[model samples]
Target: MLSKKERAEEDALVEEELQAMGPKGLLGMFSTKGAKKKPKLFLELSKAQQRVQGKNSLVLRQLDGDTMSDKLSTYKKTIRFHILAAHDEAITMVKELRGLRQDVNARDEKGRSALHFACRMGSEAAIATLIKEEGSVDEPDLEMRWTPLHYAVMGKHKYAAKLLLKYAPSPYVTVNRRDKIGTTPLMIAAAEGHASIVRFLLDSSADINDRDTYLISQGMTALHYAALTDQVKSVEVLLEYKAKVEIRTKASGETALELAERLGSHLVSVALFECK
Candidate 1:
């Protein structure tokens, strides 16, 4: 073992390296930024209609809408500031809007607010400014009952999620809150193979065995989804966090281990067997 001074020096080096990597750190490498990006998912719609939603199009003020006149709604234009991370513009407009005592959380046709757009953009500075302006942290869009935290995690915006967890009013209120589909942020992170997010949510005391209702009758836990989707690291982390291994699916009555076996996910199956 090194002396205390040497250990402190080593610790400082690690912290410096992380900060040098910017807001994303190690998780940045695994983010869905390029070809690895998957389809957009949120307050999920029917399977067929789900494809229509974009990863960032939470608002319904479409560019191609029939009423594409210059007189677009104020909220729609303001949301653009958040999406574009126009800090100076956002600050000026938001201050002006506040002076008029307007609703910062005003919803577009799809119930999305500027705050929602900020979260989707993963602009931590923009999100912090909006939250400081009294933006509602737990507001839901028409797409689903997803909170800003949900969007942050789903977008692989770890910095945004960190800010929300620290500053949002009662992180517990929305930390585990389920969407219309009963999917929690933890469940979404697992299915998408977001191992770092899985670790963060687990550390934040997210329910390790929380259940969700999918499109059909399947009542699945985070582990079930991880196993079914071949998220090997997610399976290991869930089991390590003491997630229930005995929980069975509501429809097929399959446990996570069984699901992994069925999908020929040998690595996940091996991890589950060790859990058993």
Candidate 2:
């Protein structure tokens, strides 16, 4: 993921590109006339993964894995439109499609916006489009209340996540928003053992002690998830950020120490017991 500095650099580059377009050219970029110039597309397959491509260029790097079943590639692959060159390509696509009544903010059955698609697929160009649209980035999917940033982190695409964090209207809100299951992105990272994301979320000022609603206890925090899951590095990172392991679940009255102990996570149980 880009730091604030890196994202600023990306913004500067986009500004430079936009400036070079002048006025008429910028207008033409979004016109029907530009549609003919849309890039040729292909599904580039690598091992079990697939990313959409425009001729020789990598346009959208969101991959779908194969599991020996019939490989059903998404026909909407054309939506990419070689926009990977700059997210402005998406802006151009939007303008070209505007004559046909497109709701850029429209949600799918799962309540995921196009921005969610962009993040889940690792499409920097598509992400740029959604950011340019500005209304879709923070939209949460219905099932889990997962935002575009959530999809990005779940995809393990830090660059995409960083882009959302840096450019979204409320980066802090997106970073801290909890899903329906009462888990923060931090909890997801800790439980999934995505140590890097845990660190990134912490540095982004995510609440170290934030807890979920109780499915078992009155909700366990990221520390509890990490301890129970035996994510050693994640537990260490949370502790440094002032995570309170002494906090206990309301129902079972079990601290993370007790949970780790019951789960037979020797390393985490020992750390929490000693710290207490």
Every candidate's CA RMSD? 14.7, 14.9
Candidate 2 lDDT by residue in tens digits, 4-109: 5754554455445445646432213323454656532122234233322212222122223242111112112222322222243565656734554344654432
Q: Among these predicted structures, which one has the highest TM-score?
A: 1
Worst 10 residues of 2 by lDDT: 67-76
Model 2: how far residue 258 lies from native, Å = 1.2
- Which residue pairs does candidate 2 place in steric collision? 62-121, 214-219
Q: State the displacement of the C-alpha of residue 161, model 2, in Å, after optimal TM-score superposition.
A: 1.6
| Estimated TM-score for each candidate | 0.70, 0.64
Relative to the true structure, candidate 2 has a C-alpha RMSD (angstroms) of: 14.9
Give per-residue lDDT, candidate 1, residue 84: 37
TM-score of 2: 0.64
Please give the lDDT score for candidate 2: 0.64
What lDDT score is found at residue 138 in candidate 1?
A: 86
Which parts of model 2 have CA positions greater than 4 angstroms off? 1-101
Model 1 misplaced stretches (Cα beyond 4 Å): 1-71, 85-96, 99-102
Writing each residue's lDDT as its tens digit, candidate 1 over 144-215 gives 877887888878887788888788678776678888798998998999898898999888878889899777
